[model samples]
Target: MENQVFESSEERTFQYQSSLPSLPVPALDESLKKYLDAVKPFLNHKEYQRTEDIVKKFEHGIGKVLHHKLLERAKVKKNWLEEWWLNVAYLDARIPTQIYYNFGGPGPYLEHYWPPKEGTQIERGCIAIWHTLKYWELIRTEKVIVHRYGNMPLDMSQFRMIFCTCKIPGIPRDSLSNYFRTESEGECPSHLIVLCRGRVFAFDAVHEGHILSPPEIFRQLAYIQKRCHNEPDGPGLAALTSGERTQWAEIREYLTNLDPKNLSLLEKIQSSLFVISLDDSSPNGTPEDYTPITKLSLTGDPTIRWGDKSYNCIIFSNGTFGSNCDTFVADLSPCKRLLGQDLTLI
Candidate 1:
């Protein structure tokens, strides 16, 4: 089948959003039946019968009321699961978002380009960043082709949160913050945060309409690297972000009350486009290097990571890179695919 092209802004990407199917609410009896089946393995027949009886009562009574409420919610909101899922699966939970919610993986470029030389990191970072920014521009202009199943265009909402996004911790609950803006919409944040040895720095990555040249970016990175080398190790305060969210919230509040400047700094971290981690150790491996992804992205140096950022790129001293994505569902490879080797299908 020939691919459909959407040129007009409103007619493109999210044009079908209103027509998309609304999220479904499962039937009470059906869900109760599945619940019983799932718990059956852990119970004897008598116990199972007792459990079944309770479920039957609840299904016809309170469960029916709740299910009706859910269906009404589905009618009001096309994607009812978004908030509930995020709360239950992520925000409301106290577990750290690192390994529990986020996943890590290495770049596949090593398969074709091996033997990491000293200068290659800058070259590769330039290529990667340039491609990344271009992808964002496409999304901003509504030019990135939409993905569809049969005739329905899959939702492109999540793509916006991939950049210029971070999670903000609050009392009892945490919230997500997204600052992205299309060129037509408004100005987007064009600065990137660099985290090294628990310290952080920010620099403008965009020069005019283009991303900073490799030489410029390298110079900035080199400057930060030298400063870190000469100075005593930083407090690695970023690690607190990787700890339990509510605990982090308390620490964050203390820091805020401790000083106005500290509150401003926290706001800066939350508002930045994304974070770059200048890691201390280097782990060598093949193109499919899952080890470094684990070490660098999740368990390595917590000091160098901004755990709440939507995307955290960890660049090792050896020039390898791994991504620790705050949101587990996002796949950054599409940014590569939109710029790299042609894709098979949308």
Candidate 2:
């Protein structure tokens, strides 16, 4: 597929959002049949027969009531699976999300013009962050090209969660928070969060109505790196995010109640554009051998990566890159495509 940005006023990217089809609810009997078929291989003949009878009973009883309610839900909601999927598959899951749910990959630029280079971490990171911010601008202006299948448009709603979005944990469930706004909608937060040496810092991505250039970003990153090198390590509060869901939720509530300034700091990190993880591990690997980088992307430095953020760009010490992305909010392929195209600019 090719991408072509829309410059016309009438041809906006999300123009077809209302016309897209709503999520369909499967028939209860058909769903039960498939479930029985899936379980048959694991059960003996008698067990299978007993399971089939149970399934048949349920299909005609309370299952019918639940399916009717689901159908009623589909009539009112465009995508009935949207919130339910987030809550059930992600938020309510008690496992460590960073290792189990998040997606990670080695940067494609290593095989291209930008290979691993020593002492280039801050420099390359600034360039990548600048391009990422540009992509954010495209989304804000609704100028990014929309994906389509034949004549039908696919969902573009995930793009809004690509930046300034986070998942807030609850006692037994979690909820997603998105602070992104299109240019037509109004002003949105333009700050960025930097994670280095177990510390967190925030700065504005836009100043004087213009996004910061790579050089300006470079200076900011340099200062952060310098301070990290000179000072003692921070408390590394980001590490708490890697724990079990309910436990983290309780801790988060306690943390917010500890001090009001702490709550503001947490919100600032939650609503920023995305996270930039300046890591110390330099996993030397090539495009053909990505095992080392991939391992680190998923398992390295939990203190430097926010496990719940929608996107985390991990810049290694040797200037190679890896991405740790939350798969619940959106697919990683779109961001990869955008970053791949932007890498060509450098």
Judging by lDDT against the true structure, name the best candidate: 2
Q: Top model by TM-score, which number?
A: 2
- Listed per candidate, the RMSD to the true structure in angstroms reads 7.8, 6.9
Q: How does candidate 2 score on lDDT?
A: 0.83
Candidate 1 lDDT tens digits, 261-337: 78877766777767778776766756555675566667788888878888887776666677787873371242321
Where does candidate 2 clash, by residue pair? none
Q: Give the TM-score of candidate 1.
A: 0.84
Q: State the C-alpha lDDT per candidate.
A: 0.72, 0.83
> Candidate 2: how many backbone clashes?
0
Q: Once all C-alphas are superposed, what RMSD does model 1 give against the true structure?
A: 7.8
Candidate 1 C-alpha error for residue 177, in Å: 1.0
